[model samples]
Target: MSVKKTKVHLISGFLGTGKTTALKSLMAQKDPNEKWVIIVNEFGEIGIDGAVLSDNGIPVAEIAGGCLCCTAGPQLGNTVQKMLRDAKPDRLMIEASGLAHAASVIDELKVKPLSEELEIAAVFTVVDPRQFVSPDYAQQALYKDQIGVCDVLVASKTDLCTPEVMAEFHEQAAKLFPPKAKVVEVQNARLDIQWLDIPVIEKPRYRLKAEVLPDNTMGFQSEGFTFPAGQDFDGERLTHFFNDLPKMTEGLVRAKGVFQVLGTWVWLNWVDGQWGANQVSWRRDSRFELIAKSFDADLIEQKLKEALE
Candidate 1:
């Protein structure tokens, strides 16, 4: 008698592209009777996405401080093995770090023991249309490689893009050699659950590079800071602090933090010159992370400290 293998799906995307949001949307539409587990990987030391996703009342395993395809490869394999043994979930969904190499991760899952217990399902890569048209994101080798490995190309945050940006996104997506299985535009990361059932097609044309590069090869540095649960931040002052970071700290590209503000907790996101925040129910210690081409650590710390109440 043979046991049924667990279905595995990969969610790949670049930094700050709303991959977590898409995962949440999918979870909402999942079968109520089936057991599902999630594995979230992050480039930062602190696991913000994992913590946020845990609010859904599901088991979520987080691998942080490195890319799952490289520095965290051993950890990724170990986590998968343990999850299979302990949880025995009917389905497993992995949200790879924005900087992760999808091909490398897929290779890891195909190893002997793991390959026997898990079957790769459709892979989805989420793209922000605004970044799709920007040279800063479009010209990067990692960005193109991410799109190259996807079975589905998800254009997220389309509601925020202009007509020109949307047109360019559609044009570029259509030009890919081995075309994507499906290309979709979604708002707030709402993905249709039916897409998850799409069968995986093997593409011999898509090959992984012999040498795997470290996450830092992209010239980005990341730092994560945590504060005690009792620590409180002045919401107004914190807003000003984050708003000034891009100008105050050179090379600042992405920054996100969950802070205790007054009697509530708020989640703040800063990316590509845009800032957004929302109230949330997280009760964990206040924490934040910053990713930049390069920046002064001491200066950033000092400014953040000044925002404390």
Candidate 2:
């Protein structure tokens, strides 16, 4: 008898491109009868994405501290093996770190024993249109590799983009050598669940250039902080702090945190100059993490402390 293989889907995107939001959207639409599991990888040691996703009441395995494409590859494989033997879910979803080389992750998954038990259903890459058209982001080697490795190209945060930006996104996407199976726009990372079933089209695999090192060596640094449950932040001051983060710190690219603010809990997200805080039911200890080109961690911690209630 042929062994039953579990279907797996990989979601990849650059820093702050809304991969977690997209994963949440997909999870919300999952089949009630089917058991599903999520594996989230983060560049920060604190594993904020895993914490946020766990709130949905699903079992989440987190691989933190490095990119799964390189340094964390062994851990990722082990996690998959353990999940398969224990949870035995009907489907599996992996949210690759924003800075990950997705092509390498895919290659890892297709190897030997793991490949025999897992079938890659589809690969999705989320893109922020504003960044997609920007020369700075477009020129990045990892950014281009993420796009090249996916079956579906997702344009997230479309609601915040201008018409010109959207047009340019289409123009650039059209220029990709091997066209994507589908290119769709989404608002707030609300991807259509049906897209997950899109058939995978075989394409030339993307290989990383030798000179490209792991994320830690790529000039990016990350810092994470956790506060005890009773701690609360001054909402007004916290908002101001996030709003002025780019000016207050150099090379800050992405920052996210869940904090007890005023009398309730709120989740704050800041990416490339856009940010918002929304009330949430999360009751865990407050935590914050930021990824940057470089920053004074001591000073950032001091500023955060000053915003406490």
> By lDDT, who's the top model here?
1
Q: How do the residues 140-207 of candidate 2 rate in per-residue lDDT, one tens digit apiece?
A: 77887787677789999898999999999998887553346788998898888899888653321222
What's the TM-score of every candidate structure?
A: 0.64, 0.64
- Position 29, candidate 1: lDDT: 89
Q: Write the per-residue lDDT of candidate 1 for residues 143-163, one digit (tens) a residue.
A: 876876677899998889999
Which runs in model 2 stand beyond 4 Å of their true positions? 202-309
- How good is model 2 by TM-score? 0.64
Error of 1 at 270 (Å): 43
Q: Quote the lDDT for 121 in model 2.
A: 78
